[model samples]
Target: MLFRQLEYLVALARERHFARAAQSCGVSQPSLSEAIRKLEEDFGVPLIQRGRRFDGLTAEGERVVVWARQILADRDALRGEVDAMRTGLSGRIRIGTVPSAATAVPRLIDPLCTRHPLLTAQVMADLASTDVLAMLREFSIDAALTYLDDDVRAAFRVVPLYREKYVLLTDAAWAPVRGESVSWAEAAALPLCLLTTAMRGRRTMDAFFAEEGAEPVARVETDSFASLIAHVVPGRWAGIVPLAWIHALGVPPGVRAVPMADTSPAPEIGLVACRREPESVTVQALLAAAREVDLRPLELLPRMRMPGPDRTRGSGQVGP
Candidate 1:
């Protein structure tokens, strides 16, 4: 039960390959194997299923891997806590965020770093919401920025950040109608570029469309917001996107962001972390920052107005 042995076991579980696990741990394959063997002897049970190649973990090994991850996480937490007490919070906080929520990461991290100057932040911004939660459970990410729902609330500690409001993004020329806002039915009628079905945001949009009895087919499907913007910028396809995205990445020249008129209560996005007995100091800091940060700027984007008859086409202005 040495910490090194636990490290090797956890690495093996993560990589699922003996060689890769050893490489990750910066140790030789034999060293990693011997450490695990000693750990197995101490436990008096087989932890890894043996084979020429790395087979999956045994049932007991699976259980051990779970414990190993927590133990390692706690070890890191302890070190972080001590360092915080001695100086201030100082460490890397890894955050996994859904694509739509990526724009909000800076709002959370900027203040955290200002308060704890030594603390650094790493963001993995392209993950799906499910993957964000899965990584949180595995102790891979310190926090998650994603849609907050009942299922997420039950499993982890969450700090509600903001609501994600939907908007239609299009080149003014491609806009289905000129208005301060657009209906889901009107949005569905246009050539659209949307996130693939795999994304939660896309699913949410689908539900919105379903409510209106509109089944808008995508002219182009993509996983990334950059790609979504790319398609919409050409004035060929319109995109339904979060208003926060418009705030984060300004509408391109000739593009318009019309608020969704028939949108229901927007989905709540939040900061989520594991609910351990003693939470990670990094997570605690993030939660604090989230609570204090004012996200009203995202909600206050320039109000859209219907273009006047004399207004120039492709001007890209949202308001009069």
Candidate 2:
């Protein structure tokens, strides 16, 4: 019946307990129950299953919860738009990023912050690409920094930012005896610490190795890029990282990095936001900033588009 009543119902569904739901809504249990009862009466549907205890929502209630989430999101977006119109863009834009794509956040955020001084950002790193998409879909994050591929382009609108080239980060003692660049096979032979296979970045690396007919095992597998750096810094192991990371975080004193001359095409990493007809102000601001971001620094150069045919292994070049 009322927005607050809808809020109460949503809380009840999320917490799945009357007492906890009331606590979450900062209302007494009786007040929460009364609100839900009124909501059900107004809709002429028994939203909640009645019993001795708080049972789950009814079938219709489940659908209501789904609608409630979207309704609340749209309502919040409307409020954000009004606030932006009144006092410029000013809100914390939550940006989720795949661990390997973390460096791309600052590049997108800085321009927005400069243009809209009131705008602030929070970056959650070490998220897998799947997690990034999940958070975006749930409205948990305003945007995400991830690889823009066919799998995601259909769900989220993408603004191409950079083409991430691979690099082998190793301690000086562990680097190859040959030249500056490291090949997939040579880097694979080292005592390696790499991102967990669950991450798309690690999967891409795995695909590269598989294509080269090599099976390289990592000494350590972690979700955090910091962990990889920590291992490499102490001479414990080596890892593969993007050139953006080396530039953004810089290689620590004990670590050295060389570009991996993998002949396979590089993946294009970019900003992805939900494809809403009327995007929230924060999302709009981020999209605008992404459009203006300078990809030259990352050396994406022309910034290739996604979902093209995989480059053929011309000349059968699998290694450096």
Q: Quote the positional error of residue 241 for candidate 1 in Å.
A: 1.2
- At residue 68, candidate 2 shows an lDDT of 79
Candidate 2, position 247, lDDT: 62
Using TM-score, give the best candidate's number.
1
Task: Report clashes for each candidate as comma-separated counts.
Answer: 0, 0
Best by lDDT: 1
> Which lDDT tens digits does candidate 2 get at residues 1-320?
57888899889887999999999989999999999999898889999998988889999898887787778778888888998999988867889998877876887788889999988888899887888887777676778989989888887799988888877766655536256576787777887989888788889998888777878889899887777777777777778877777667665665556668756878888889888878898898888888977775774211222234864332211122
| Candidate 1, lDDT over the whole model | 0.86
TM-score of each: 0.93, 0.83
Candidate 1, residue 68: lDDT: 88
lDDT of 1 at 97: 95
